[model samples]
Target: MPITSYPFDGQDTTETQYSLLFRELQDTGIADTYGGPSFQVSATGAGMTLSVQPGFAILRGHAVSSTAVETVTLPDAGTSSRQDRVVLRLDPAANSIGLAVLQGPDIGQTQTDTGIYEMSLAIITVDANVTAIDAGKVFDERRYAGSHVGIWTTNLRPVHPRRGRLGCNTTTGRWEYWTGTAWTDLIPGTADNTTRWNGYTLTVSTSTPSGTPSPDRIWIQPTS
Candidate 1:
C-alpha cells in the first residue's frame, strides 16, 4: 500500500497495459544490476572439485596473491552438465596468476579466464556460454526503502527465490532468475560502484517487490 511513479507515470493508461509494461521492465531488471552468492571455498588446490551441488558456491581469493600457480579448482559437475555460477572477487592484486574457472565435467576440463582491471568483478554465466565478464553496477537508489547489505551464506539454491526476483547466480555466475515463465540470464559484467551482492532495477515499480525483499530472500538488484 504505497505510491510509485510507474503506476502513475500517466493517468490514461489501462491496468492491463501497465501490467505488460511492468513485465517487460521486470524481465530486464536483473540485467540492469549485478547480483548472487553462496558457500565459500578456498583458492588453494589445483583441479580439486569443490563440494558444491547444482546450486551456487563462493570462491575466496583469501586475497590469493601467488602468481605462479597453474591450476584452478572446479565443482564436481558429475553428469548433469548443468552450469554452476561462481561469484569471484579476486584480491585486487590477483594479477598474473594462472587463474581460471574449470568449465565442465572433469578437473582436467576446459575453463574460462578473466581480466579484472584491479578492483573489478564479474557474474559468470556457466554452461553453454562459459562466459566471464566484469560485475555490473547496482544503482544505490533504495536508501529510503530500507538499508540493503551484502550476502554471506553456506548454501544457496535457485538464486532467485521467486519470479521476477533477479540476482547473481553463483551457480550460473550471471544475472538470472525464474520468471514464473522461464529462466533468464542478463548481460555479463557490471557497471561502476557495483562491488557487492545485490542487483538494481532500471527504475522503481510497485508491481515488483522492492523496499527490502521477503525474509530469507534479499533484493540484490537495486534501481536508479
Candidate 2:
C-alpha cells in the first residue's frame, strides 16, 4: 500500500496531489447556491453563439472555473431538430479542461456519460436550417451535489427528489423530506396528509367535523 501526505516546509506539490484534495472536498458537479441556478447558459440573442457565464465546477475531482464569460460557436443544424449539450469537460489524460458539445438525436434524450468526467451545463435545441438561437431554445441542465441540503421553492425543486432527501420548501416555508413514497413534512405536527392555505389554523382530527365550516377554520383528517 502506498501512503501519501504533503504540505511540509519546502514541500513540492504535484497535479495528482491537488486533484486528490479537490475530489475529497467536493463532488463532481456545478457548484450551486441553495435553491439557485448555477453556471447559467444563454444565447447571445443572435447567430449560433452561446455564452456560459462564469462559474466554478468540479470534474473527476479536478476543480475548474471560468472567471469571465466563455463563448461557444455551435455547428450548423441538420435537416431535423437536433439537441446539443454544452459540457464542462476534464480530460485527465491530457490534463485539460475544454468547453465542448455532445450532439444528440432529434427524437431521443441526450445521454450524459460521466466516464469522461464531464458536467453538463445546458442543452440547446436547434431547429432545421435555423440561423439564430434564442433563449427559449436552450435548457439549463446543471446539477448540484445530491447530498447538498438545498432550499427550493415548489416550482424550483428538483424534478425528482430521492428517498431521505431533505429540502426546504420556500412555498410552504417548511422543511420536507422524501419518504420513498411522498414528500412529508420534516417538522412535527403538520404532515404530508395535510394541506392548508395561507398558514390558516388547520384543525386535524380523527373524525369529520359536525358543525358548519367556519371562515377562519380549516379542518383536515389524517389518512387512515
Candidate 3:
C-alpha cells in the first residue's frame, strides 16, 4: 500500500504541513500578549504618526513575536477623509517579514497576492487636512482567529495535554472536556469510550472523573 504521511521520522516536512499543524494549534491571527491584545495599532500623534504595540501572532505557519514597540509614520492626510490599513506582511520570495501601511480609499483592503501573506492590524481614518490622529480615528481591527484553543477532532488532540485544556471531539460530534486525565463528555449522559482513532484507546466518562493520566494515549498521525 502507498503511504503518504506527514511528520514521520526522517521525513522532510513542507510548509503546507507546517501551516496545517499551526492551524491545528491556533488560528492565523493575533494572540493575547501580556493579558492584552498583541500588535495593537494606535495613533502616536496628530501628524501621521502611528504606533504599534509589541505583540504576538500566528500568521499561517509563521509565528511573529515582537517585544519592542514599532513606530510607523504615514504620509500626510489627503484633501478628503480616506481609509488606510496597517498590515504585517510576509514575503516568501524575499524571505522577509515587515510592516506596511496600505493607504487608499477603500476600507479594510489588505494585500492579497501569490506567496505574500498579510493580515490587517488596524484601520485608520485620515480626515481632510487633519493634524492630529486621535484614538477615536484609529479603529482596532485585530482579529482573534484561533479555532484550536479548546477544540479538536479525532486524531487531532494535543500530544502533550495540559491541565484545564478543553476540546471538542468533532468525529463523535460531542464537546469533550479533557480533565487532564480522560476525555470526559461535557454533554450529560454521553459516553465516548467506544470512540477510537489511530488504534489508541481513549477513556470516556459520562460523569466527571478525576485521576492521574491514563495509560492509553492518543498518538499523533497523518491528518490527510
Query: Which candidate tops lDDT?
Result: 2
Instruction: Let me know the TM-score candidate 2 reaches against the reference structure.
Output: 0.62
Ranking by lDDT: 2, 3, 1
Local distance difference test, per candidate?
0.33, 0.76, 0.72
Q: Candidate 3: worst 10 consecutive residues by lDDT?
A: 215-224
Candidate 1, which ten residues in sequence have the lowest lDDT sum? Answer: 137-146
Where model 1 places Cα greater than 4 Å from the true spot, the runs are 1-155, 188-224
Q: State the TM-score for model 3.
A: 0.60
Tens digits of lDDT, candidate 1, 1-224: 97445455446765435544643433211121223221222233223323211212122221223323232344443433343333333332443322345343332322223223121122122233222221221111110111122232315634444445455656556655555666566574545332334443333233555455544443333455
What is the Cα root-mean-square deviation between model 3 and the actual structure? 14.9
Better of 1 and 2 by TM-score: 2
User: TM-score for every candidate vs. truth?
Assistant: 0.16, 0.62, 0.60
RMSD to true structure for each model, in Å = 24.4, 9.0, 14.9
Model 2, span 32-125: residue lDDT tens: 5433445788999879999988877777677777888888988887889888888887776687877887777632322333335677888899
